[model samples]
Target: MRLFIAEKPSLGRAIAEVLPKPLKKGEGFVTAANGDTVSWCIGHLLELQAPEAYNPAFKKWSHEHLPIIPEKWLLTPKRNTSKQLGVLRSLVKQASSLVHAGDPDREGQLLVDELINFLGVKGDKKAAVQRCLINDLNPAAVSQAVANLRRNQDFIPLSTSALARSRADWLYGINLTRAYTLQGQQVGYKGVLSVGRVQTPVLGLVVRRDLAIAAFVSHPFYEVWAQLATATGERFKAKWQPSAACQPYLDEQGRNLSRALADNVARRISGQTGTVSRLQREHKKQSAALPYSLSTLQIDASKAFGLSAQQTLDICQELYEKYQLITYPRSDCRFLPTEHHSQAATVVAAIEHNLGQLNGQAIATLPLNLQQKSRAWNDTKVSAHHAIIPTLKRHSGLSKAQGQVYGLVSRNYLIQFMAPYEFASTEVEVSIAAGSFIAKAIEPKVEGWKQLFPKRSAKAGDPAEDADQLLPNLTKGQLLSSLQADLLEKATSAPKPYSDATLLAAMTGIGAHVSDPAVRKILKDTDGLGTEATRAGIIELLFKRGFLLRQGKSIVATDTGRIFITALPDVATTPDMTAQWEAQLTAIAEGRGQYQALMDPLTEQLQAMTLASRSVVPTQLKGLGTAKVFGKKKRARKKTSA
Candidate 1:
């Protein structure tokens, strides 16, 4: 018999629907008419064995066992899914041919492959196993994937990379957590001081920001503005641009720090005639942002609906798996596969159908040019999955949250088929008595895709102060009269606390926060601190561990969180180490790096860190108080028939 081992049951069902008819369903599998069986794992059927599995003494957390490195790694069946493992083992023994159907990413590759290896599928049997990558659960997409199976052996590098990352996380988190918890215990703290490779650095970011905010001092700055009238009787205001002579009176940021200098500039510019030294006008066009990657989607959802990152991911998962409204949700790629261009009309139709009467207007009435291909269509930029987009399946009766998220995805996709937003800009520089005053304005030429979005309210300190203003036509060398002059006093504001939206944006663009150029480049290329699939979970985990708290819309570090970060070594608190590890992991996935090449150095580092962890002063952990315990809520069991 030929068998297909899928990553999850929904996927197995997706595959089964495309096979021969007369399907027979079993407890944990489905058999097609052609004698092809499909079985699935409930996530991972196996996980890395605990330290106690390596040695009995390792179970006790003590200073003597600080750096517990296993000579050989081992895997054991997960207790919750052991029954599914047995079911698959029986099917593996009966099947003559195997197809590995897993999600099209690193973790997905390892979960199913590890099961195959644990089931003792080796020698010729393993060599012949086929690999199927499914990023879309639509029957048409799944059918195409099934017919184009590749050799599972071709993905060994990917699986190896995932294994290396898993082991690395295990070693780093397990050892550091134990060591820190021991240190905290010695300091009379009653809770576990958990630490993670990614989680610690993230917590460190919040703590440092809080400290900076508290220590920041506000200072007053001065600016001089002159009200001018054009020859055509048009009035406008232009701020004075300090000349080189004022350098001695300015601050490091070039702000006018002297009220006397500001007063002199305002007085000189008042009731004076000036020539228009420069007049500049230009036309500009901007395309709509590309479709949503998981991180981008999370950031937008947080900003628009106040949804947390995890909540957005959960809603997207349902939209992908249960409702079949969208493609894979955990994608890091924002570009679409070129082949997907052909399906644009179908996807648009589905979106129209799903959105009918939901919005007051008919979606079909919108000028959606199906033939307009934007830069978003690029095969080279697509990763394991394309952008999160609506599929050609229409349904209604979605919850309000689902509708909100789905609308966002659909609008982004539809706008790609529209023209770029176009505008005309004007800038005028007036010269009067040793001071330069400038005014700028922007005029909308075409609304284009921007019409689909609602108008945003003006925010404080918006950089585009003249975005909505229109300047009067004025030519160079034209004389204008200064009507009035004013000196404005402003105080520099402290950095605002991170809102959910800004925090996710920070996490995605963390490279800007790092000082080292090499590490910054690596992080920028690697898409920051964590993968799209895990970033939401990492942020949520920080909150669960009492390291982060929410005040209104802002996320702040708790007292315990601040102390924990302050107590850690710089290596543990910074993003540099994690960025390097990610770059190495990428190399491993591309067949350019070896697992041992990365792990060997990490082991040595851990040994040093573990020894140094012992010297952490117990007083540093004082006043942390008792930590809150978080556990999974158990599901109520279904009563079985006797």
Candidate 2:
């Protein structure tokens, strides 16, 4: 019997549908017509063994054991999942051949791979394991993936990376959480000061932002503005163009920032006729943006539909699995595989058909613009999965959320074929005796992809101060009779709180925050704290753990969260630590490093960190804490006791 194990139930069924006909369904697995078995794990059928599993003494929290490092790893079958696990074990016993049909990513590979290893932990050598990486559940993609299966051993490095990450997370979380929980308990605070590799860094992000927003003081500034009319009575608005020598008024970046300077300039320019000193015109074109990576999709969904990251992920998953309208949703890459261009026409046709039924006038009329090869089609840029795009299967009856997300994916794909947005830009520099002012206008030549998402009004998606305005043709020597100037007072505003849109963006390119150039480059090459597949869940976990609160659409750290960061060691505070570890994970995946490479440094860091933490005085969590033992006991032994 040949056995196939999937990471999830849906994938198992999908695999079953493609293998053979007359499949027999069992309680936990399916028997294909060819006598092969297709089974699935409901996520992981096992979890890491708790501290108590190693030794009974270690179970009890104590300062005596600062850093808990398990010499031998362990796994216990998860509660409520034993039934399916038993079925897998039974299938494993009789199977002459095995297939690991897990998800294409490291986590998925590790889940089934670990299960097979655990089954053999009792010295039962099994058949050679083959890996099946199925990106799409469609019959063609599934068939191709199954036919091109690689030996399971080929993915050992990937599984190694995953295991290293899991172990390090355990080492960091278990040791630090227990250490801090004990410390906080000594300080009279009661709670599990839970810490995690990804969770801590994410919480630190929100905490840092909350602090910055709180500390920010708004400063008043001003800019001089003028409304000018051409000889033909054509009107336009201009702003005082700060010169290179513009003192105190100019910022380090040469931005106008002084109110007094601005007021003087405005007062001097008032009622004075000024000629157009320079009229610069240029024709420019902007290509359409690439399709959605999970991060970009989440950002757009948050900004346009006000959907949370989790909500967007859920919606996109359904769109991919249930409706079959989209491809994989948890992709990190915004670029399509270079070879996928061959399937572009079919996908476009499917999209047009589907949109024709929904709203033909708006979406169906989209031109077939998939021919242009943009930077977003590079094979080198494609990662585990390509960008989220419409699939060839375009069935209807999707939920409202599905429709909104699908439309975004389809529009992005279709726009690649359309012409680039073309415009003619004109800048008029008007010079008076006191200062120079500038007026700018952009005349649209071709809407390109923007035609699909037309602006509703003149100030669409723009601030009023920098809104697009129409400009009349004017010569360099032309003078305006109607000249008026005004001083506009603006405040240097505080940094806005992070919305879901902004937070996801921050998490995606988090490597940018690193001061160390070498480390930052490594971080840049990888996702920051969590995988794209897991970031949404991490954020949700933070909320459940009382680390964050949602204020409207903005996410803010709670008081407990803030205190936790202050109370925790530096190891648990910054994104850089997580980023550095992720860089190692990346290395492991690329076969450049080994599991011990990560575990060694991780273990050493934990040991040194825990011992150092033991010496420091924990900050009292006032009001939330009671007066209690804040230090290692200082009581002298009674002489009579001996």
Candidate 3:
């Protein structure tokens, strides 16, 4: 009998429902009409055993067991999941063929691969292995996945990549956590001290930002603003010319030269006709944003709905796993390949039916543009699923917040296929007594995808107005009969605090400082620091560890976070470290790099880091109730005779 292994119970049940008749469900296996037995794993039924699991002596935490480097890592069934493993093991023993139906991602691949390895299945002598690749849990997708099953060997590289990452994280987490916790206890602290590869770097980002804020010395600077009236009696604000060069006159020595400067410039051309020195205009079109990947969705939700990253992820997960109205939601790729176009249309149709009259018209007008593709959007790069898009099932009974998030994902999917927003821009240059000033305007000819979202009020000095412009009748040398002007002073402002939206963007390493075109391209391709599935968890972990605290939308580092970052060596606290590791891992996946070659250095580096951290002392808290210093402190001296 053929044995089928699915990633989870829910997915397995879904697949079983779609199989041919004569399928019968058993303890943990379902028998197909052809005598194939299908079973599923509960995520990861087995994991790398902890250090203490290897030897009884290692059970007690101590600094003496500083770097517990295992010569050969061993896997054992997780206690809670042993029963599920037992069922699978029994089926494997009787089966002549095997099919892997894990989630179509690295972690998913590793889950089944590890189970098979632990069960002592090897080579062709073991049941012939095939992989079921389904992006959605619907019956049609499931049938297609089973019909087009791939050889297991085709995904060995992917599974290897996943295994390498898992083992590396395990080694780092176990060794560092034990070493740090034991050291803390030795210093008289009782709290659990934890460290992780992703969590540590994320914590470092918050701490670094906090340090920058603390070290910032505010500098006062000024700008001169003047209000001017055109011949048509329209008022607008104009700034002094040579804005950057005039800084000295405005801010130097705190000297006031307002009257002197105004008089000197006012006499130059008070009555002279302002010339349109430059009248450059161009028509531009911007395509709609690609569909939602988990990270992208989290970013937009945080920006548009004020939801935290974790909150957004939780909502998406619920929508995908429970509601079943969306595909796997934790993907990074944004584009669906041509093969998926037909299925995508079905999903859109379902969305139209669900929206009723609210957004039915907009949904009905979606144009399929699968032929055009962006470098950022592609099929080959898709790991787990083809970005998060609405499922072929009509959604209902959603909470208000779920509806809002669903709207975002659905709209993004439809908009990506629509035409780009087209607009015409106009620029007018005017020369006044003060200096040459430029006025710009825009006229949007087609709303296109922007129509999907509600229009918002334009902010002051916004450049969006330049997108759609129809200038009033005017010539190069138009003279003005009368003019009015007002001068106002504005102060330079400090950098703004990080909102959840901005923090996610920063953590993803998409900052303005990433100026190189190639590096920026790489960052875009890689989806920044961590995978979408993992980024929110990393943020949540930071919060749980007392490394960061959220103040409304802003994230602030705790004192402990700052001290921890400062205590660690510089290598532990930078995005570059992750980027470097990713580069090597990618190379390994592409067959250009070896797994052991990459891991050997990492293992050594971790060991060195553990040793170095041992010599460093942890900081202590004082004078706080029940928060005593970790290390011994000098007692207060008794009163001395005078």
Candidate 4:
């Protein structure tokens, strides 16, 4: 009998519908026409063994055992999932062939590989193990995936990557958690001082930002504005002393000078004719952004809909697992290769039909000039699944939030296949009284994919007015007159606290000040700090650990969190550590980097940190129950004398 194992129950059931089924059973298991038994795991049925499992004495927490490092890692069935493991174990024992149908990502590959290894299934001496690589859980994709099942050896690297990540996380989490907890207890603290590879760095970001905000000092600034009348007597506002340095003059605690200068600058330009000293015009095309990756979707949702990262992820997961209307929700890739474009129309049609108000007309109306050809959109770049796209399933029975998220995913998918937005820009530079001033306008020739979000406003910090403005016919060197002028006071603002949207962007290493193209590209490729699947969870873990608190949309670090980050070495707070680790892991995936190259350095660092911590004298404890200590001989003598 052939046994099929799926990543989750919903996907397993979906796969069963397309199989040549003989019978359907409860939960996620089914029997095929050839008597093949298929079942699914609820994510992972087994996990790494706990610290206590390494040694019986390790079960009890003690300060003596400062760091608990397991010599040999072990895997054990999860307590609540042992029954499911039992069923799978029995199936594995009896089966003549096995199909690994877990999710197509690294985690899925590792789960199946771990299960097989744990069950002692291997190497010409056991049932054949095949891997099913399905991008979508629908019938067609499932059928194709099964028909093209690859041998298990082909996926060894992916499995290795997954195992490496898990083990690294374990080594860091277990050792650091024990060390901190013991230290805290010795200091009379009761809570667990938790840390992890990703969470610690993420928390450090929040703490750093909080510190910056707390340390910021605001200053006053000023701007001079004038109401200018055109030759036709139409009124428009213009600013005096349009140099960037003008804003800083008023911010230097010279209110008297600032007011006097503002008045003088306004007077000097009141009757000046704004000249067009230079004329620059260009035509540019802006293509639609690539399709949604999990990270991108979360960012857009948080910015556009005011949803939190966790909220966006939850919505996407529901759409994928429950509604079955989208592809996998944890993918990092954003572009579909040329081969996947043919199926794009079908998915779009399905979404348009099911989503009321969006129809075939809307899909057809999208601009034709845009095409998906980004670096992110490669077939080989996709591992277990392609980018998140609408499934063949018609959208139905969705909650309001689901519909909103689905709309975002679906619209982005169709928009990518559309043409780029075309526009012509006009810049007029005028010289008057030996001073040069410039005026610019843009006229949109075609709306392109921007029509997808027609009602959407410009993003925050963008000019309130549209970039595309039709300027009246005017020649350079022709001048007009002015009517009024005024001065405006502005304050120098501190950096804004991180909202979920900006925080996600920051975690990905796309800082507001990072402008170097090569550096930006590296950050993008590396995903800044953590994978999309883990980033939100890392933030949530910080909150749960009292490292951060949500003040409205802003993430503020707690005092304890700040102190913890301050106490840690510089390497622990920076993304460079994660980036360096990721680089080695990627090399390992491609057979260019050795696992020891990464693990050895981490092990050394861990040992160094442990020793450093042990050498430090713990803080004195206060308010604890008082007790007296005596030499063992004196205590024994006193007891005998008594």
Which candidate number would show the highest lDDT if scored against the true structure?
Answer: 1
TM-score, each model? Answer: 0.96, 0.90, 0.86, 0.86
lDDT of all predictions = 0.86, 0.78, 0.69, 0.70
Name the TM-score of candidate 2.
0.90
Clash counts per candidate, in order, are 0, 2, 6, 14
Give the Å error, residue 349, model 1: 1.0
Candidate 2, residues 1-642: lDDT per residue as tens digits?
988898888889888888888999998899988999999998888878988898889878987876888889999997778999999989888887889988778888888988998887323234377889877777777777888888888888888988888888888888888877777777666556778888888788888889998998877767778877766788788888787678666665466777778877877887779888889999999998998888789889898889998899989878877776787787877888777788878887888777652223455466555677876798887756788888888686767777788888887888888788899999888888757888888889988767767375654432426556778878878887536677777767777888888888888878765578876887788887688788888787677666788999899998878888877766577777887788888889889987787788888888787777666555655446223332333321111000
lDDT of 1 at 141: 91
Query: Total backbone clashes of model 3?
Result: 6
Scored by TM-score, the top model is 1
User: 1 or 4: which has the higher lDDT?
Assistant: 1
Model 2 worst lDDT run, 10 consecutive residues: 633-642
Q: Which order, best to worst by lDDT?
A: 1, 2, 4, 3
All candidates: CA RMSD (Å): 3.8, 7.0, 7.7, 8.4
Clashing pairs in 1: none
Q: How many clashes (backbone atoms < 3 Å, residues ≥3 apart in a chain or on different chains) does model 1 have? A: 0
Q: List the residue pairs that clash in candidate 2.
A: 369-417, 370-417
lDDT of 1 by residue, 87-127 (tens): 99999999999999988888889988999999999999999
